[model samples]
Target: MDRKRVNACIEEIVKARKADGGLKQVFWVAAGGSNGGFFPAQYFMDRESKSLRSQSFTSNEFFLAPPSSLGKNSLVILCSMRGTAETCDAASLAKERGATTIALYIEESKLTEVCDYSFAYESISYDETEASEMNASYGLFLAMVLLKKLENYEHFDLAIESFSVLDRVYRDAWNYTLPLAKKWAERNKNESVIWVLAGGPAYGAGYIFSICNLEEMQWISSPTVNTCEFVHGPFECTDKNLPMFILISEGRTRPADERVLAFLKKHTDQNIYVLDAKELGLSRIDKRVSEYFNHLLFSPILNNVYLRALAIAKNHDYHYRRYMWQEKY
Candidate 1:
């Protein structure tokens, strides 16, 4: 991947926005893993940009009831690993509505043909889990570009530098997580149901792992809830024998997650598994950026890898799916 080219493309988009008196809104549209990948970026924009409005939507939802705010002064980002039919239709709708559309994908397809700008990453023989993480990285880049234009986004340079070294960071994260993943898998292999929890940016990681990887791929019953929401009602579902997985973010939301963890430890005798991003030694990543983005970057990828281990431990292939590409949905 040429970092220079990515930067250039971002600059082009920024220049266009400036020439048009600036973009008023941004929409992130996708489905399944791709929709999951948009969460952190959406979070970043919400937290960092004061002037730009951003929203995320499932591809079909966007096409069915398009936002009234979407127009020539809006930017719409679409994602599709294989360019799904729904996403392609949404991109075409976005373009027809006069929004500056950008498609981030791994291949050239209907999505690329419909968008005003398309960025394609090198195609790899990676499963949906791996592709989700890769797409998240691309989404983060898009977020940063918009952030740079909306506000100076003080940490932009450091964030880009940190992203460039994520390959190494991912390796270290996997090395640290492997044994733990295997152990967790062994304990939960026979369990009928499990719960996953996270807060803030890490919520996306928890959601995707539980829904896309565990439930969808492994045919396990898993429910994911925001950590902050745990105490409201979901706490009633906890018990001594239940299994729970918690993803602890390293950012401001850490306290929210810690509060949930403390309550769970004190109240339930259930088996609990926790993965904290701060503990992952991601070399070369900026400390502050790591605090904000590590949970988003590390948790999902690590969870995917962990699921693969769990699949192997249970004598099941992670790629096994009932209705994924094998059957019509």
Candidate 2:
């Protein structure tokens, strides 16, 4: 990631602020896995920003019907792994609307070219860099930097301090989760549906794990529900034999997740595979802002370690798609 470019882009936006106002709203626009990756950012800005509001939009939705509030005072961050058509079009529309656009993508393509600012958070050589850098981490960092500039976010320094030890936290998570993920794969390799539950900052990890890793990559049936909302109606599906993968976030909403877990543990069989931030050595980062890093800590374990093991157990290639890239949808 080019920290200098990111700083410069946000700096320019703040410097050119019109006398009328500063930034008012932010639109996190993307599709599929990329859209899910923005959830942490949406959650962060939703909680942190006092002068600004934030919303997430699937790419075509933004292209077809962007918010009326999307004007010069708005900022739109669009992401796509390969710069897909829908996302590129959304970036174009955002640019046409006179909003400052930031494109987060792994490679340069049409979307990057059209947006006002572009950051390649990861590249072909991303694996050679720190284990902490991830697509979701980029989204969160953008929010952190923007908030630091606008509101002088109280925990800003602590947040940056958190980043420094993320590679450490990530390594610890991997070492701890490796044996557990292997066991998870062996357990759930044959299950038809493995429900995933999480909320708050950790929601994105669950989203990507369910939709992107399990369904899209593994061809498994995995539906996700926010932990806080599971009790409202989804609780009816609970059964002793039902398999679940519950991720516990360290944020304020953790109690809500705990409530969901408590009910599931009693009603369901011992099939609830769990990963908690408290289990990982995330204490190296300050607790004050540790919530923001939960997804980052959970991501590689979910997508890289667990799902890859599941793929091997099922004798399926993670990159193989029966329908997706093979056809023109």
Residue-level lDDT of model 1, residues 1-329, one tens digit each, is 44567678767776787777778888999998778878878888878888888999999999999999888888899999889999999998888888889898987899998888877753222432332237677787788877775688899888877776766666667678878888988998888798888888788778888887789878888898899899899999888798999888877778989998998899874599888876665434676776557545555454556788888888888777777888776
Segments of candidate 1 deviating more than 4 angstroms: 17-20, 122-133, 282-284
CA RMSD (A), model 2: 1.6
Residue 187 error for model 2, in Å? 1.2
Per residue, candidate 2 scores C-alpha lDDT tens digits across 1-329 of 56667778887887775543878888999998888888888888888899878899999999999899988888899998889999999999888888989888887899988988877766312345464466777888889889988889999888877887888877767778888888888988898888999988889889988998999988889898899899999999998788999998887999988999999878875899888888887666777888888887877677767887898888889888999989998
Candidate 2 is scored at a TM of: 0.96
What is the lDDT for 166 in model 2?
87
Residue 25 of model 2 has an lDDT of 82
lDDT of 2 at 303: 72
Relative to the unseen true structure, what is the C-alpha lDDT of residue 222 in candidate 1, on a scale of 0 to 100? 86
Clashing pairs in 1: none
